[model samples]
Target: MAKKCLGVREDTGDPCKRPAGSRSDFCFAHRPQEGNEKILNLQHDPYHCPDDGQKLWYVPRLKLHRCGMCDGVLLNEKEIDPLVLESVLGLSKVAEEGLAVECPTCSTDSDLSDGKFALSNFAMEWGFAVQKSKYHSVYYCGVSNVGHCKVCGSTWFAGPGERDALGKNVGKERGFWRVQPGGSKIWGPLDMQQRLREERLRLVARKTEKRERMREKLCQHVDSNGERCNRRKTQKEGSEYCFKHRPK
Candidate 1:
């Protein structure tokens, strides 16, 4: 009997029924290319990072695609719960309104146009035991933004350290806070709502700051007629012109 392929299908989350290739656990179509052990050959086309044009590598073990350049992570809807559980033990959290971005999967599909990834704020609670008293600490997972594709149910973590920040308080006690006997009070639903509101305001402020910075970096190149291009710069560093107007 021929050995079965070890590769998993991304679409249906089922094992590939194809026969394994000689000297490999996966079939030829599912075999990971040489020099890229972490990248898998999934059923769907490869995804690219929206923040950076870098190709997203499919990590079979993790069931997600990660951007090598930006450290961003993309996950399917089914994978979200498992990740949350692994990172923060699925603790009660809050999410704010979504921020829109171009969807990686839908962008490549010819049938889809203007598909968007709506990023949202995911705040998880971390409980700390200090002097035998429990205190709650809220951690936001969207320091850099966690986007979700409304069209495909995919989640994107635009990362330099977003994923790490999500799991920062996992599995460990960090600091101690002195609390009076009656000072340890449990937060009610209203308190959580207040915290969420505050977080939304902070996020809005941060977004505004980012927009201002980007506006400052707008292309400074003038055309032959001396009209300013007024477009965003291609690179964050170096040239001041957009890709089309940049000098060779």
Candidate 2:
């Protein structure tokens, strides 16, 4: 007697009555091969996807639980834990202060004062798929925050610090030398040019001083024109000219 295929449609849970393969319990349509059954279940899983109420699939090796219809990624148990802990422990309070920071993109300060709460919460979900079967499991994930810069409409992820989503330091004022004396203040363009000019003048003065010292050490030997030798004095004991210009 020919054997009936032991296969079921993951989406409708209907039995597949096609004849079994020569050496397999399942028909070619419901075979457990990697690309065949796996890819097929992704579009016809038994459980409905929470995102769109369509079929769902779980990939054990890859730890991926996704909706077949909408292709929405569902978080795993390990990934859901942090969100649950934060929500239950009221960690959203830390994100409230994040709105006080200045937007790094536009430099405009973000303020949540006018009933625009920055510490918003969202619902999430986790899903699990059976490795070789069409069964799926979904769990209520937790809450998350959708961060955005209020000033420029730029997206951001808030951290539990005094900095904004753009990583710019918060609550700090920017200006020119409200900067205390001796503190590291960046020089402005004109101020930098003035500094460069002063440095150049100082270097020129030092060079002029060096040249005067060299002139002061000139040889005292008289030349044929009755003029003192302009050569530097480098002789020992009693000589007056440099070694090459000395009276020889």
Candidate 3:
């Protein structure tokens, strides 16, 4: 007699009723994919992925829990370095101000606005020229793509592609320096861009206000022939007449 499949249904958490495949404990429908057999025999309770609501599979080889559907990775602070090289991007500090996702391990909500965490894109660059080498690091202020949980130090990368995307350099040209009366400061590209945009709008508002004042001060002098003098007032002393219509 064929042995019963030793697989549990994800939705019902019940053993699979199908017969086991040849030389395998699971049937074709319950067969583990390549490199993911360990997930079938979970020693502990599985955690649900916060991003896709899928079952989080624990991979013993990598010592991390990963979502098979969305390909999102979840790991504690200690397990981060060995598996993810991008831990140097400062996941703890770069999570932007907002609630990203809940922690799969502890179910704690990861909110960056609680004043303990900061947000932005953590970037790095390195190159080699013959026998010489150079490395640089910078931060992009408005990019808050990665989700981080401060409670358990679990960082969530939406997918493997997002992890690779964080490795690229956000060029320095996009940043700008701001000089103030007290001192000077360097601002990230996105932050500086927003500031410059607001300044331009302020200048435009001032010009518009001046034009409206001039329009209101248009000379009200009427000639004896019944034609109104519509010339603009240029006097700073509050004279209501233009040079051409001023009283002699």
lDDT of 2 by residue, 102-149 (tens): 222232133334534232322111111113345753111111232333
RMSD (Å) of each candidate, 1 decimal: 15.9, 25.9, 16.4
Model 1 lDDT-worst window of ten: 175-184
Cα RMSD of predicted structure 1: 15.9
lDDT of each: 0.52, 0.40, 0.49
lDDT of 3 by residue, 1-248 (tens): 99887665543234468998998877897776323444553423566776678876655545666666655566567866532334324333433436455566665233343434321323221111121235644322222234555556665554423311224333322211101100113222334435643554555566678877867889868899998788877665878788887777
Q: Considering every candidate listed, which one attains the maximal lDDT? A: 1
Between which residue pairs do clashes occur in model 3? none
TM-score of each: 0.37, 0.22, 0.35
Off by over 4 Å in 3: 1-44, 82-96, 108-144, 160-248
Cα lDDT of candidate 1 equals 0.52
Task: Give a tens-digit lDDT track for model 1, residues 1-248.
Answer: 89987665543234578999989878887775323443344434556777887766665555566666666567666766543423322222334443355777677564455433433334332122224335654443223344555567766655534232334432222201011100123111334434544664665577678878977799978889988788888875787889888888
Between candidates 2 and 3, the one scoring higher on TM-score is: 3
